[model samples]
Target: MTDHTPSSRSAARATRPVRTKALSALVHGICLSLLVGTVAPAWAQFKASPAVSPRIPGNRSLSTELKIEGMQATTDYILAVVNQEPITHTDVDKRVARITDTAPAGSRLPPPEELRQQVLDALIDEKVQISHAKTIGMDISDQELDASIENIAAQNQMTLEDLRNRMQSDGLDFQRYRNSLREQMLLQRLRDREVNSRIQITEDELTTFMKEDPAAQAEVALNVAHILIAVPEKATQVQVAALLSKAQAIQERAAQGANFAQLAKDNSADTKTKDQGGALGLRPASRLPELFVATTTKLKVGQVAPVVRSNAGFHIIKLIERENSAQATYTQQRARHILLRTSPQQPAREQIDRMNDIRKQIVGGQTSFAQMARQYSEDGSGARGGDLGWAAPGQFVPEFEKALTALQPGQISEPVVSRYGVHLIQLIERREVQLTEQQQREAARSVLRERRFEPTYEEWARELRAAAWIEMRDAP
Candidate 1:
């Protein structure tokens, strides 16, 4: 993670900003989504059926059920061993079950034998990586582990106690669950350190990437105001024609110098932005819906586009502003957040409830946001009225970023759960800025790193597995 230095006004809370990191992609890939499946205990039921082949010692068929010591009676056997660490038949079954359960609807799976071999290979690779992580003295602290568990609980909308009780109800040992989480964290840390260190992006590569990347080339920011004449679902053709006529008339009025804002305020059906003069605010072309971007692409400022029909209805759009510069620019946001750190002492649900009340008070004008933040926020930013200064995309974690993007200026978001803690975020404002030369290079570097992360990780894992002593025991 890279630390962000706050502006002079908020310098006292310089360290309070949630640092940005290139590992956000990896976090989502290896930590958040994977942990949900990897840590959850799966109980596989192996029904008694006729065996296709005779069961040999140390070579049990899939249908064979054998009682194992210190565990429930189930069909289990040693499948492989990596550095003396055994992978069991039960482990494979559980993994297979998870894959099957989580597979997208209508997706096809490989043949059973092929799938089993693939799962076994993946298990061996995991064992090798875990062994290497431990060998390198990489470790996850108890505090970090606790935070990760809390994050998982928050993501599931459960309190810490609720998570514990849910796990117990599912017949999973709490300590075992914690161990699984720790392992995942260790794996994430290991990959971030090792894989990132291997990637190198040169100035030439950066320049080429900037030129060749389609998104980078078309770096345009747009501010558009729209008036929607909504067409109700299953409406008659006459009703549709009437709505279309209304939209065309509004577009004509807007083009003929009628007050667009007033027209939107009075006639626009989009409740969220209608009162804001139908302004969608400044956003990059990538952030705006494709329909809006397409309609406004060739429009000059103050020009009104012809009425366009969509699934929702007809839209009369005005191009408020367009920034299509030679230099890449993006919409940056200045947001402030009141963070409440969650722990066993103050569970997530309690903190969430508290944040809700605080939001209500601030919204109702009973208390100022800054005052409440100063009184209740746990982070150093509290001293600076919880200001997180100007930030570009990818500066915050994905969960935080998603919530921040959804809020308008001065709008406080509902309690947002991130790995760090729960936060009540208020977007201060947004601005469009051209990236400096150095900033552009840095942005290119980030993109290059993301592109390299996956392949580098795979190569690193393969190397670890090849160096380890892997023995395949039973072939099933």
Candidate 2:
């Protein structure tokens, strides 16, 4: 097996989260501090340290941790050597065990080796993202990471201390749990940076696509607001009534012209978007609780509605924005770009120079933008000469689409930085986007891309594994 360990790989894998099922089990939602001093005595199970920890300068704990990890018995092989890393049978066994624990009691589980291989593949892909993140110098602060961890733990119905103790009882180490949280957080950051930040879903595209599927088009947008009081899933009748009354009072205040958004900010317990002034932006009406949609359509913009109760919490909703079922206006835009990729490992300047060089070439007419995009655009659409086919407003990354929409046909944009990379774009054509055959094809493609993220991410993991260095040893 080929070995590609960074000169630094000898330090043992402790500081890096194990990226296995055990780590996922302990701190699935909560943050790292939940694991403090919670490691149980080594059991028969294979143990890998969770990698989420505050980075100490030259810390050697991870190496020591893994030396101990190897002491456990290996039950099965997880994956074949990729590059050189042997994802062991024991690793697979742990992942399957963890999955069984999380699954409903009677669920069928994957065979030992099959589950192991899948988990190992995912782990390798995660490593690619982590490695990429490091290249771009993207690091999560321990404070924010910890806060995220705490939120996750609370959701799992456990206190930080209790969660740690449970992990110990399961023969898992708390540090490994923290490391997993850190890694997942890091992956989220990278995904946002790599994909979401750069993706543009245009209003025209949404309209055209939905038009092809009457069901999708039939969906109406709901402008919703709520005053939430969080109660346990099994709250008493008196407690539930008290919470509902509190919601009613908040609604009364809202009807009296108290700042509805500010009221939500102050009183809403739906922390997800409460701080956004209780804005659940333009959701499909069907997805709203039946009572909410029924009342929402009856109110005009800025009108407060009656209180609505749902399993999530109690709420008094107000209508802030609404879209009638009328079809949206769309404008087709053709654009071209030259792109340069940046990662945490590379200095920003390295790619900046490359983008600038590409920009200079276009300006100097050394090569057309389309030719350059075919050669260098890192995006999937690069194959189409960076033609984002047709976009209406809101279709491209806001920054990119904004630049494109501002240009007349044949106008070229200056280099713009988006999460994906730096891009130089041009507008080639402009036309109103209404439902058309061309639009339907693109719409179907868009639907597929959204559906494909998880599988795509998994496949990407496999590809990374195929190219990475991994080491495996026989069960000791």
Clashes of each: 0, 36
Question: lDDT by residue for model 1 over 326-353, one digit each (tens)?
Answer: 4646678998888887777877778888
lDDT of 2 by residue, 249-333 (tens): 8889999999988988888876655788887766545435567778776799999977776655666888887753335434566
Give the Å shift of residue 82 in candidate 2: 20
Residue 332, candidate 2: how far off, in angstroms? 5.8
- Tell me how candidate 2 scores on lDDT: 0.53
By summed lDDT, the worst window of 10 consecutive residues in model 2 runs over 58-67
Per-candidate Cα lDDT values, in order, are 0.66, 0.53
User: Once model 2 is optimally superposed onto the true structure by TM-score, how far is the C-alpha of residue 422 displaced, in angstroms?
Assistant: 3.9
What is the lDDT, from 0 to 100, of the residue 150 in candidate 2?
43
Runs off by more than 4 Å, candidate 2: 1-217, 286-298, 324-326, 330-336, 341-349, 352-390, 393-421, 424-476
Could you tell me the TM-score of candidate 2? 0.40
